[model samples]
Target: MIPSLGYAVLLIIGSFVLNLVVSKIRFNRKYKFPNVVPGWPIIGNMLDVPYPAGMWGVDMAKKYGEMFTLNIGGRRLVYLNSSRVVTELLEKRAAIYSSRPYRPMMSEIMSGGARIVLMGYTDKWRNQRKIMHSILNGKQSEKKFDDELLNFILGYTGTLGEYQFNPLKSPADVFTWLSRLPKPLQWWRPFGEKFCETHVAMFQKEYNILLDKMNKGIAKPCFAVDVLHGAAKKEFEISDVEKIYTWTSLIEAGSDTTRVAVLQMIAGAACYPGWARKARDLIDEVCGQNAERLPNLADRSRLPYISAVVKETLRWRPFLQSGVPHTLTQDDEYEGYKFPAGTEFSWNAYSIALNDKEYSDPLRFEPERFMNDDLKLPAKGHCRRICVGLNVGANNIWIAAACILYCFDIEQDPEHPIDQFNTLWEEPTKPPFKVRFTPRSQAHIDLIEREGNIALATDY
Candidate 1:
């Protein structure tokens, strides 16, 4: 019996070795990228990528040219560190490069395969994308809601923040095989179940609240109202869960990123008061010295400097620094390199936006860089999978930044100096540093009160 057990062990070890050898041979033949980050046997660069994935990719890009690869547990992660490669593959060859990689933990368990952000390229995803475009496409700036609903929106946003920063319960998310254990042995199961329940409850509550308002004929013409009132008539096969999550997804997409962009702008304002004052002057010229009214969407074309400031804010510290990973659906080649189907591609927005080759002074907060037509802002995403809420989010940021600069002079707290690069927060999306928003003057204060009262008093 002992000898038989020994032989069984030997056979298992031999099979493992053979499988590794075969995988290596196939990988070498398929992937011709010269700059592969070295890694340990079998594990293959799992430990090479550091936290804050974006900055690490930028460093690697500098060391390994425009494109590089990291083999993580035999899975190839191709990092496109420049805009040119990202556009070429994700845009020009979008037919094969537009799908999303499978995320079992986040999508399957926690979301029950309903999260639109991580959904693969399928008919369902396409239909959901259509719904998103229908709601988020046109002029969303004109739509207005009362302050009470805005407060509820804030509460909903806070709930999302709480869930986002919850501590990780399972390390097996990356190694999906571990997530497939028997029900009782799956350590992450309870957490994922709880997340799903909480997510559903929150989304359903918000949707119902909006739906109630809509039924009463008191709901404003917003994304939620549109979705609840059947905005996408052509989009069939969308389950109730999908519709609920879709509502939350649009908010999720716009909320954190938009908040970060606005905070970054405030940080920039505090850091460089001159530019803030310059933009403020431009705003003043557009609005008035006394601030007769707050900056509106109509003033967007007139406020070129404010537009430049928004452009610079987005470029300098992009919302999706590491970027959403796009999975290739078929075997493909780029620049004499071959990649097989299922290879995951991530464009480093951090690297591309800050690339010295692209930006003259990439590190500096230079809004003037965007003033000229020669310099174009870095692309957020490309092709069919680009952010559906791009227009709404951009308009939000522009109007928010314009209003903040118009209302107050942002000043950094001397006690806790602002570190624009300090991502070490319980939730990195929330601003790490505090700043004071000193009213530009009493007239500005009065204007805020007057407009806010008008907004609050206006019927839905």
Candidate 2:
């Protein structure tokens, strides 16, 4: 009977707490934004946000205007939806905006504080920024023949076997510069090849070769090579573990990201045929009928609309579903809310991108929305370790998009109607990579040779 009394008392207390949370959530009846009340101890309605984060920002902004506080595991996270507010906190107050939030797990297993992308504002960060600035800033990024080499290596080496199995009549079937490989891994399927095996094998071989040459001091300095060399020559005084960490960070800060950007551009073209056609028409006007001479960096001004389309593609489907979670190194105040230092925060860009106030006809796939100078959107930079690879990313997208626009007539399969397309709310996680770029015409061959060949003339 005594134990029963104790259990009943505890149950009563738990019920009372649950009721209190529910009331607080619905306390202000007029306001609402997917806010969920808390459950038992230490747990809030964290799972309420939509998955793949589709309409993520728009929904939140609609429910909670300029500012809304989220209770995540007892830590309060404030989401700033207004552009002006964001500019104020993340840009104007550079002193406060620059410090990075702690990422214990990633810091432990991965880069710690070496790479520019995730590193915080610190002495080491300043050093990384200095090196990064030298490596990637301003006109210096015009590292003549450097990107051209990477483009070809990515083209020739990355997709060689696939071309062999699925032979291409295109003139691009010419370069052969790869390193060694495992005996069994190099073998291809007699029929439909397991492409990943070949991709891994060949890529591993070439990457190893590049690594070996880099280590031997015999090869021309690639991006990674040059940066790491800077680190060494500068006597970074880092551990061997950190060297491996640096290399891994460099790869993360570079590779797959650029690839994904291009892939999204392709996927968007395929899904929205009208936009692609519009871009192609613009390209034809400036670049001429012969799709053979791909647009270079020089053509950006002449073909502003094409540039608009590229920007639209990025805006439509950003790769990451959310802004990387940001942690505060120092406490700050916003409005009247006192947010302590070491707090975690993030803006749901997906939600912001689709927000009605920020964009008109937000759901419509219209590049024209960004046509006028009055309303255009480039990634507004932040002080807290802002994106370091903007030029690399932009150049890659511009060049790749220019190439695709010049040569391909991307169209959705009529058999697979619009309804059949995946109506995902959030971008899928590690989504299976699938795409199709139908070659437009024979002239595309000439263009590849004209632009690609010149760039690839002497291994970049």
Candidate 3:
């Protein structure tokens, strides 16, 4: 009887091993990909894919060249590590690469697939993107959140370096199966739910107020106004919950990412005083030291150095480190490797932005690299799925950096020198550091106060 039991156990083990081998073989046969990293049986690179994928992705790119594949629990992820590859796939082949990957935990369960950022390439996503574009693209975007309003909001909210909703964490957590656990068992689940609920409530409240203002024929020209008007005209059908998510997602994108860029600029200024001096000198030359006013959008063209600073800040430490992942809708091939349909592609922005081939001394925070040409900012993403708030975000960073540099000289505090490198992992913030913000002159201080008062009084 004991012999028979032992034989039964052995047979069961043998069958499991056979299943794993068969599964792996089937996957390989279906998807003829390149630089495939072998993973554990059945799971397929689940354990191999690192946490904080952006940092890991950079190392992988160096080792595996521009493109590589990782199988995470049967899901195929293709990492595009070079600007050429990202532009080729995400931009050039946008039709097939614009869809978002399916995430049951964050999208369906946590967010009800209502978040615009997480929505797949569908009619809903297209319509939502259209609404966002109308509000935040082209010349219209400049009016929506002008420099003054943006500065006021940023200061009022004190959102800089504050931990808002982290979109990156959800994807990694779900991919690792942690988000699949029961709420009671998952520590982050409860907080995530609460955060979503709070935002939903805020959006609902704001939507109702905006709708009422629209009824009164006194609504402001904003995302909420556009969405509400569209629904009234039957341009699209969106539920209250979906609308809430859409508007909130826009706010999250516009606000949090820009805030991070500005903070990084400040950190850069403190770390490299010489560059900061150059920026200040440029701002003074353009805006005029005795102009008795802070720099605004009108002066943007004249301040090329400020633009370069903004570009460098974005490239140096992109807020969305990996950019948004795009899922392929059809099977595609690049450089002789076949990528199966449903394969999700992530642009390793960290790798591409810091590519030594693209930028000399890639790690150095040099604004001069972007001075001569219109270098693509991966922080805004790429292709048909590029960020709708690109123009607004750029303008915000440019004006904010100009104003800050014009008003004060930022230097590292003698008491608390910050470890800037270690702070890169903070999602959108540098480590806590004290910086001396000495006014360039009393005239500068007076100018800032006068302009700030005007900004506060003016409503967007």
Best by TM-score: 1
Q: Tell me which of candidates 1 and 3 scores higher on lDDT.
A: 1
Please list the residue runs of candidate 1 whose C-alpha ends up more than 4 Å from where it truly belongs after superposition: 1-16, 141-170, 231-235, 373-385, 424-430, 456-460
Q: State the weakest 10-residue window (summed lDDT) of model 3.
A: 156-165
Q: Estimate, for each residue in 115-209, the C-alpha lDDT of model 1 and write its tens digit.
A: 88778898878888888887776665345322223333444454333332221323344566776778898776787788788778867877788
Candidate 2 vs candidate 3: the TM-score winner is: 3
In terms of lDDT, model 3 sits at 0.71
Question: What clash count does candidate 1 reach?
Answer: 0
lDDT of 2: 0.55
The better-scoring model by lDDT among 2 and 3 is 3
> Which residues of candidate 3, in runs, are more than 4 Å off?
1-20, 38-54, 146-194, 373-385, 414-418, 425-432, 457-460
Could you give the C-alpha RMSD of every candidate to the true structure, in order shown?
3.6, 12.2, 4.7
For model 2, residues 132-209, the per-residue Cα lDDT tens digits are 566676664544223313332344322322231111211111111110234243232221134333433543555566
Pairs clashing in candidate 2?
52-426, 53-426, 54-425, 56-351, 57-351, 57-352, 58-351, 101-327, 292-447, 331-341
- In the range 288-337, model 3's lDDT, one tens digit per residue, is 87746778888877777888888888877666566556789998878878
